[model samples]
Target chain A: MSEPISGKSLHGHLDTMVLAVLDKSEAHGFEVWKRLEAQAKGGLKLKEGSLYPALYRLETAGLLTARKEEDDSSRRGPRRRIYKITRKGKRRLDQGRQEWQHFVSVVECVIGAPA
Target chain B: MQDLRVHVEKAVRPVVADQGTKLRMREELYSHLLEVFEEERATGDDEAAAILRANDRLGDPAALTAELQATASRVSWYEGAIDRIVHRQDETEIGHACRLASRYLLAIVPLIIVVVPTVWIIQTLIGSTQKSFLDLVSDSLWFGVPFGVFATAQVFFFTIIAHRMLRQFDKPSWRPRSIGGVFGLCAVSTVFLLVSSFALFSILTGNPRATYELMMPKWLIASSLMPFVMTGFVLARRREIERLEPWSSLEIADET
Candidate 1:
């Protein structure tokens, strides 16, 4: 066998997971962090520093754009900068999808010995 | 429509900058969420809660804005260019006035170079031996007459440009009262540059008392240094003066 089987190990794969979630719909900083936290399934965690930096990099690469907007939940309307995916971001998400599929298939190819 | 706009704003307005994009996103998302809200309404839902739920379903505002911004970059770069194009009447007027003033000065200044020297040589050669006030008057008037006339024309033209510039700003009436100040500045500087340039030429060509030379070269001191220094002043101040006033005509609170 050339691989090991693990149910959930998404922490190291935060970028892919974060992007996959975004591929479904646009989200804010807190929403994205919360969604990724939930999807961890007990095996993934994202630090604010890590998640924010990844967001910033994706933004700088023409894959994302950002602007300030009022969050309305504000007792006082502090600015919240929101990000959105571009066409390039969607293509990147598609490529991420393909990679994840390949990775899952590679693992599935080698992990069997009667259950 | 009001509820739809608010709901759409909550979902999409945070990300988009354009009125068209905001309206479009509002309509599209509202149509989709309207169905979901109606389902709750049919189940005896409260109006406010159903509307709130519809907005919630649209998802994170920050995420939406960011997505739109990202998409903006991918959209044709011309979209941003449209926002930058000047549409104000004041901008167009100022632009036109600047072009006219520039062309007028360019043509007149060269004319000054032509007419000034021809008159100077003729008057200098034909002068009386007398040094009386009338003779001095004639010497300079015959020579300085054309030069003085041209300078006067230049001052009037300078006043016109400065007055137009003053109009562009949305200040108190006191702003235009300073038009005379600009004219005074240009006039004084013209004198200083001319005197210094002529002093240099007088020293170089040996004190204006040397052998009488009828014809001077094209690159003589008055023509070269006078225009050069004066032009440096104009070119240096052109951009700053043009932008000295703010684009908006919004009035400010009076402190006086």
Candidate 2:
């Protein structure tokens, strides 16, 4: 089995990952984690603790907005804070995508494309 | 589920943020952990084992708290200054006491200015009668100069006493008690000064009844009102100190 992706390797890209997840649909903290994990296909071993600070950082930067909603589901818990990506977040995600593409191209130049 | 809540509380408890931010974090984190716990349970794990797995997934609480504090919203400069004054985390006890005493002395400066002139004028009017307007004006200036000097010296003496009393209480926790002690000392000193002044004036003029009739009622009124004034000042300052408490807690958490 391939090595699982560590949170340290994904540090700089967490914001982009969060914004991308929320951009598809606004979700609470747990759902956001679920979506990201689902998208990574079990390869990303995201530390649940790290996700929150990233969310808070993004919210502080005005890249997303969160509002508390009373959860009516059978599995009762505290009010869930629903996070929605802002227009700024989408713009940042686009910028991040371009940067990633450029980085990939630079790496491919050094080590040629796979056969 | 209760275990999950407890774990979340422990995780967020050390985060050095305002109440609103901390509360939000607690609720969100608890919600996230609860979901994780339920998922683990769904996989046929026992309740205790599920809690363990959920906690493990969340990672270390200390590392999480550090990150949360780093990413928390910034406090305004005014709030930060109040926190610094309230905690004085970097200052030695002696330094903090000196600063507090200096602030007390500085606040009393305007009160001294107003009181000294008023007292001089009142004394001059009461002392002189059956005299020309020119004589009255001259006597007022003569009384004002000496009274101003005396009042300044008296205030400086009291301030020094207050400073020394403050230095005795090395622990910050004793500050409120020390303030009350200082105010009580000032009240007692004011009454003592009034009695002494009365006795001195009687001796200098060579008439006890005349001195009492001329100065006793006025001085009594001024002395009686001083404690109330001091009480009001203390109450206002107490309110400001209370307002600093929440921010003070953040500073305390940061130190830990």
Candidate 3:
């Protein structure tokens, strides 16, 4: 697991991380939660309120598409809405990554934030 | 992905409260989860552990969705209340519409039956002093093919409306086609009878008033006295009626 990134690390870089996660395919709310958790090695705690709102905002931004499916109650579970990344989403993810990397370099060169 | 479908199918199959909505919700979640799995795979973790780790990080799927129970409860309560209000409104509106439509059809059919045929009959009775039945029929055919089409239209309409109205009463939902069919049918019937003779045409048209007047003018009297008729139709197909009135509170059992 990578060292925990600060909440500061998360502020400008969430789109990058989310795109990085969804890059492989579509993901629902839970997948986004899990991937984000794993990105920070379970350290970036995103409340559902924040995570979902962000996902929704991204969706409205033409980066993600959310769809609901019938989740039969498990022999003992419930139902949920799944989200997917579109082509525009992939492009944005790539752009976000490049931007994050540039921002990281600029910060490292000027502010000298620890890696 | 397929595994999630199986999970979703289980959630939907045996029937939970609000099962239809839950099932729809499950499919949406499954698509999202499948994407997560793909992302997990793409990160190039140890393939063997990736799904496990992803699942582990995801916490409990059921618990994740428990958030929906509150939403579901609220939505269901809203749905229930709305169902009643909606159904009541629908019944009032549809009932009013049905009554108005029936009244219009009744009056129009009689007017049609009497007027169209009487034009022909009066022509024949007046015997060439004025415009004749053949003149009107033939003149229309000048542009309209003069098949005595209009008189036929009257009869065809009358017969079909009588039949279709009976059917509409028998079934809760009805299409405009069911009623419009009377127009062409009565047209044909009128043409056929008018071809026979003046007396036969009058006989076929029957009573103009019968076609026009309401059998039961008072919905208050009729509706109050015969609410059971509406109840019977609604109860017989409870599921469908419920769907139509999503806000209805009636527990009319679906005919599974």
Q: Which candidate wins on DockQ?
A: 2
Q: In candidate 2, what are the lDDT values of residues B103-152, reduced to their tens digit? A: 44444555556765665677668985456555655765565544544554
TM-score of each: 0.30, 0.54, 0.33
Off by over 4 Å in 3: A1-9, A70-78, A113-115, B1-256
Q: In model 1, which regions exceed 4 Å deviation? A: A1-12, A71-73, A113-115, B1-256
User: Model 2: per-residue lDDT, tens digit, A14-84?
Assistant: 98999999989899898999899899899898779789999988998999999878657776666788999
lDDT of 1 by residue, A1-115 (tens): 3333232344446556667777767776656765765765544432232345466557767777777555465322223456678889889888988988898888887784347
Top candidate when judged by TM-score against the true structure: 2
Global lDDT scores for all candidate models: 0.51, 0.71, 0.50
In terms of lDDT, the poorest run of 10 residues in model 1 chain B is: B247-256
- Candidate with better DockQ, 1 vs 3: 3
DockQ, every prediction = 0.02, 0.57, 0.09
Report how far residue B253 has shifted in candidate 3, in Å.
Answer: 35
Docking class of 1: incorrect
lDDT of 1 by residue, B1-256 (tens): 3464454455443443343443434434444455546656787879988776655655545555554444444232233333333222355544544444444444456565676566555666687333454555565555454544444455544445454544433444223345565455555555654554444445445554341232234334453454344445555555444433221232323201
True contacts kept of each: 0.00, 0.84, 0.14
Which lDDT value does model 3 have at A6? Answer: 52
